[model samples]
Target: MSEAALPSRPASSLATPLLILGAVLALAPFTSAAVALLGGAAIALVFGNPFQGQTRTWTHRLLPLAVVGLGAGMDLRTVARAGLHGIGITAMSLAVVILLGLWLARVLKVDRDAGLLIAVGTAICGGSAIAAVAPVMRARAHQVSVALATVFLLNAVALILFPPIGHYFHLGQSPFGLWAALAIHDTSSVVGAGLAYGKQALEVATTVKLARALWIVPVTMGIGMIHARNNKEVAADAPPVKKPWFIAGFLAMAALVTWVPALHGAGHLVALAANRALVLTLFLIGAGLSREAIRTVGIRPFLQGLILWLIVASLGLTLVKTGILTVG
Candidate 1:
């Protein structure tokens, strides 16, 4: 069954190498961020779009594994610590990010949804949040993909610069978790920062990040309702996706740790592995974005992203210090 022996294959085959590259990249320190920042260099050197084609399509399957594994880290107790504050924390964080983002975009005179795309991308899970919101808001493919690249570029920058900044201030886990949850743009960088400091920190940091993730539900629902009323969206785009069952699985994973207690050892390890895998998924998404398309989004999108990012960074600490939010 040697592939070389088969009838000459199409030039369109890249499935094997991309997966292997993703796995290998996961092991490198801040690999996700490094790949994202430098992935373009690889792409340029190769003179091909590894970001596209059959290999890229298959990468989506690996995504669920990483997300579900992330669930293994969260638990009932983590949620309990934040309480109504969980929703408030996410709400407060999102509110600040969106408001500030809009202001920057207005100043820059960028497109509205494009600005919001930057807001969500920077505020939540970077591209994942932007992708989630894009359909709900009915943003154009150009704007949305551009937003993704904008977020990816900043993510790489954060990886290079934030860790040293976190160190410079002598931040510890509780504060560090808040800094990460609010400040860092994606779970990969947050986890990288949290883990580099210590595993215990990553556990708390991831939980905080998950609490932030809870914002996606209400945020999407609110945006969907508004768009539906506005008639801005095409009929085909807004079809309801029953909240994925994995959310239940995520909640269940968290509960198993809190209530069962017996699963802690195994659960902890699984969660840690999941955090690592999630990092790879982010880079994979980053790689899929085209270089020119990425640049078309431009420096303004990043400025908008940065505005939201800085607000979160500041307010995250304020809320944590003032006792508005607390963590395990």
Candidate 2:
């Protein structure tokens, strides 16, 4: 939808649209993000920005809470196995994507900060990775916003494309899960793709993606240290970011599910709640993907992200096809 057609509305008038959005999210959990994305854009086209006051609350606060909530349904043993199995692929893909993205950014004459954000987002978890590293890199607000937009755009595409591609290849749950985990940037897309594939795919993808996300702390700290040594002026200006404590919540929840025998009977209920929470999270993510955010993203950053993702996706599929990156 075009931006010009959207008219600004007061907060009071948003009640109807918000209720409509909630109902849609509940009814169509699987396609909530895609729906919210198109529906949000349409909302913008018709009613102006639908996320003025609540965007931050939804994206920053609610989303992570939902992810942590998901952990309750996961077992520590299964998560460990998934993490160990995915290490080789995750490490290899991350290194290759970062190096390739850096070279591509230089070739395309993109800004280094924006390039790094895109590379990190492509290599690890999408917006979360970028958000964690941005403060350490002292990235400008516009750069962070643009990089996030770029990742979100690709995530939307992945949600639609990866499932069909996996099915066309007749990939088993294990390989398809690995493919989705490695190729998709964000947890939402990974989960979305996996859900479209099968139940087993969702289980495997969730564990692998969460394991991959743990790299954010070390990666951000290492980058910060490098910047400090090479460019003291930039390092001095960089803001310190708190370590992501949400990860601990996720791990702890998994441990609880695994070790606490008493909670075993509650598995179904926890899983149901978690799935609903994820639907809500995706809906919020889509609603926050405003046209203004997309407008801030430059052509070069978007190109860099697309190219990096293509390279990673190709390499991941090849490894799976070759048995080099087999799923347990």
Candidate 3:
């Protein structure tokens, strides 16, 4: 169904107010990350998101800041250790997910760009990966939207389901964090699930996910060069690669805390505040999931994403459980 078919009055009148309320609650100490996401989603589905554009813009801006801020509480040593430890698995998983995703897209007869975007998103860091690769592939707006919506929908599910599943299986904090980092789509969702699981999980997941996210640079550049080779005109007009600079910001913050022991207390406070901002970020992300976005996802793209995600998640879980993917 087209967006025009949806009722407009509630979106025009109530959406802003509901969105504001949800954002306020998300920042409040009483609400958890999952609750904030659910509340924002409920508001959007019921009233539609009048501020959908604004919400997306804010989410993009705030998430990085929150991630960097959380880095203040981390030890540089731990960050380095986690990143280094996960390198082998991260490389292997990215290769597997990308190849498997492309195969699925071709078999499913899904649009090539959309399928590739979904695969890249799942294989790397969800929306960030898609955002980087979309410009390289020169995907159409609708194709990008379909891929993003599929990933977004799955992110919400992973955030809610992962903690419970971790508990059911009695997964340890480090293992669960590693699993969440490898399995979940978005960094925000990975961090949210980690937070829900435990402190150690949050730390491990954030470090590993950010390390995984760095793959976007090489991957996007590779795709851009390939696309350029295939189409000279498109190559001439290809956009410059957008690096994930926030990762550097995060590392800087971690280094600052690690080198200057005097800032430890202050850094802890900053990290705590950043965690709250992350919850607020998730709420805004949820608010962007309007009915129209859901409608735009369609079925085939969603199926491809779902199948790819399941395969990755299952394999990651097995590897982590078997101690093959442990963070040393």
Candidate 4:
């Protein structure tokens, strides 16, 4: 009986080891921002591909959900601050990115839908934006995969280059933070850029990043409505999800943060966990892109990212410099 039970124990025992591995990878440096690259690399090398027959299993189903669990920390402070203004910003940014990028793509002879997807993703919250708007626009999976790749590459580049650029310009903490939040692709990128600078910069970057994230909802809704009117025929299966679940989760999390601030937990632990989740998630998304998608997207999306980065920087600087938004 003991011998027979020993065989069953192997499967049970694997969980501990996997968890330990995850923990170590997420903290290889013990105390540094590079831990993200470390952990993300470990996951990518180990369980990266869905077709590898690992993530397809019942056990691996929790991985995407774990990524979703990052939503639990959304908190209300982010929501209350965003409110009506956030809704407006989301509308404006999405409209701007979609209209401008799509027009450019058409002129360049690129796929209009793919171009629009890339622009929205770059301008808003990165992958989430692409993931949300892709359905309404009838984007191919590869298009999304490509859009993410383009944004992810730029994000990694921004993480490395933006800090020194910020320093060279002698941007103050608040101005630098806003610039990073606006220019960078996502929260993790913003945090990485901010941390590379200082504490005050980190706080400022996060505030602006969250502000940017609030734009996803209206943007998706707006895009969806436009699609409904414009597309004469769309597959019944297309635009599968009614709305972006993450946006809903994001909003709910913000509400929780405001109404149930008690649940935010201690500052250090929750903040640390949230930051870890943000970094790991972003890196994983970047690594998930297919090679074919990269070949297809070419320089159109990259050029769009560069253009948006410039716009975000100039706009963000003006907003801060002119006291459009208050930062302490």
TM-score of each: 0.77, 0.87, 0.94, 0.70
Which runs in model 3 stand beyond 4 Å of their true positions?
A: 1-12, 232-241
Better of 2 and 3 by lDDT: 3
lDDT per residue for candidate 3 within 1-328, as digits (tens), equals: 3333444434757778888888988988878889988888988888888777688889989999999999998999988887787576678878888999999999999999889999999999999898889887887667778898999999999999999999988899999998999999899999999998999999999988998898999888888888888783443333345567889999999999999999999999999999999999999998888777788888999999999999999888898888887888
Q: What residue runs in model 4 are displaced by over 4 Å at the alpha carbon? A: 1-23, 28-31, 38-79, 82-94, 235-239, 242-267, 289-293, 318-328
Tens-place lDDT per residue, model 2, 1-328, is 2222334444347745764665366446455444544565455435555455575466567666766776777778888887787566567767878888889889999989889989999998998898789887777666777788899889988887888788888788988998898899998778767766777888788888888889998889888787767664543333356455666787888888789888876865776676666665665566565556666676989999998899888888888767788766
Model 3 TM-score, 2 decimals = 0.94
**Model 4, range 1-328, lDDT digits (tens) per residue?**
1111212211233433553455445433243444454444344444443322232232223223432344454444543453444455655765776677776667666566667777787778776677677777776655665576677677767777777777777778877887787777765677667866876787667656666676777777788788888764764434355333544554555455556757667434555565565544434443343343345557866676667666766676677667675542
Q: Give the C-alpha lDDT of model 1.
A: 0.63
Q: What 10-residue stretch in candidate 1 is worst by lDDT?
A: 1-10
C-alpha displacement of 238 in model 3, angstroms? 9.2
Put down candidate 1 lDDT per residue, 126-168, tens digits, no spaces: 6557767778887766676567667766666666675566677
Q: What would you estimate as the lDDT of candidate 3?
A: 0.88
Give candidate 1 misplaced runs (Cα > 4 Å): 1-22, 25-47, 51-59, 73-75, 86-90, 233-247, 282-286, 314-328
Clashes per model (N, Cα, C within 3 A)? 1, 0, 0, 6
Best by lDDT: 3
